[model samples]
Target: MIFEMTTQVRVSNIEEGHKWYETLINKHPDFIPHKGFVEWELIPGCWLQVAEGELTEGNGPLRLGVTDIEGERERLIKELTIERFEIHSRPEVPVKWGTFRDPWGNRIGFFEYLDKKEEETQIKSILGTDSSRV
Candidate 1:
């Protein structure tokens, strides 16, 4: 059985990659084990690694969940200068989502649950906090 998982994205310049990711995630990396690589434990054992090396494409659109997809999208555009992308949703779908790429060509995106009750449950369980405050 799989107990843990990690995803690594490559970048040609580690320092620039670190700065861009920091702005996107709103924190310094959780760990920098050595030069040219860093890791963030996005949730418990799940890790997102930024490593310096040859870049690759079609690797992502690694979507993350948020309480406010539209707001996060705006913030990312304003702060990181990412192109404004359309948010997509369907009545049958529980969440709305939008995808964009990072500076290193790693695709990433955000999604927000359309139902507040469901979103609250998600926030509370994932963050271990009152969803009302989220």
Candidate 2:
């Protein structure tokens, strides 16, 4: 019965948090119900919430699946001025990934699947979009 979900990331200030996330996610949030809280419905029922509060240490490297992790990492650096982070991978792992922290220190990362066909299938299922779009 747990059909929907949300993951929250805390920041010290809502104003800065909102602006940063908008830039990182490349769009405005799906909803901002009140002050100090904003939410993005990343895909259908999955939500990522940014809220105002003391940032917790050792929180997360909430890895988002991408079709091109290197491309996305470079874009984040150029656009958001994110510090360059290295991409790491191994034969045992299915994807290569890179990690970085947000301005408020929330650990976030991007991952690209090794198997293109599998990545395409996931993109279609999760985003309900054409595989080419991934």
Candidate 3:
């Protein structure tokens, strides 16, 4: 019966973390409730929060769905100066994925579906739009 969800990652400095995440996500946060916290509604009700606090480890390689994993990886490497991370996949796997740590050491990653049709279907379902029309 869960209607919405959120995942939080902590950073030592809110200002730097906010800018880093903004660059990675390519958008300003959808909400900033207080001085030390910010949130982005990544997809409808699902939220990703960045907070000012002590760092935590082994939290998540929070993999976001993307249309192009290679392109994203390259962009991140160039923009964030993150070490190149390898994308992995198997014959039975439906998507390719790669993980890299943020400047604060939070695990984050991207995934791209192997099937373009399935990718479009998910996009249409989430956005409630006809891909052919857009």
Candidate 4:
């Protein structure tokens, strides 16, 4: 069975890319196995790697689930100086999402479930705790 996954993005400079991703994710990488490569375990089985290499152009708008999309947008703008991006949703859709680009032009985005209960359940599942109690 396909049980785990990893996604990679490339940048010309490892130091700058590492710092940028660390700030965006609000934590240092969980793994740095060698020079010029770093990774974060975004969830239990999913990993995101940033490596030193040619830019991976037009790769993705890798969306992360968030509790507050607008708040995250504001934080990214203030902290990373990213250009403001619009959040969108539809009546038929269960979540709202927004996209922006990192300094190296990697597409990144965040999403928030409209149903707060569902979002909480997901959070608990990923973290193995009731976030509200923590």
What Cα-based lDDT does every candidate model obtain?
0.88, 0.89, 0.93, 0.93
Native-structure RMSD, model 3: 1.2
When 2 and 3 are scored with lDDT, the better candidate is: 3
Clashing pairs in 4: none
- Global local distance difference test of model 3: 0.93
Candidate 2 lDDT tens digits, 7-109: 9999998998899888888889999999999999877898899999978989888878877888888888998899999999999999999999998888999
Off by over 4 Å in 3: 132-134
Tens digits of lDDT, candidate 3, 1-134: 99899999999999999999998998999999999899999988899999999899888989899999999999988888999999999999999999999988999989999999999999899878986763
Question: Cα RMSD to native, each candidate?
Answer: 1.4, 1.2, 1.2, 1.0
lDDT, candidate 3, residue 67? 91
lDDT of 4 by residue, 1-134 (tens): 99899999888899999999999998999999999999999988999999999887889999999898999899889999999999999999999999999989999999999999899888998889868973
TM-score of 3: 0.96
Native-vs-model 1 lDDT? 0.88
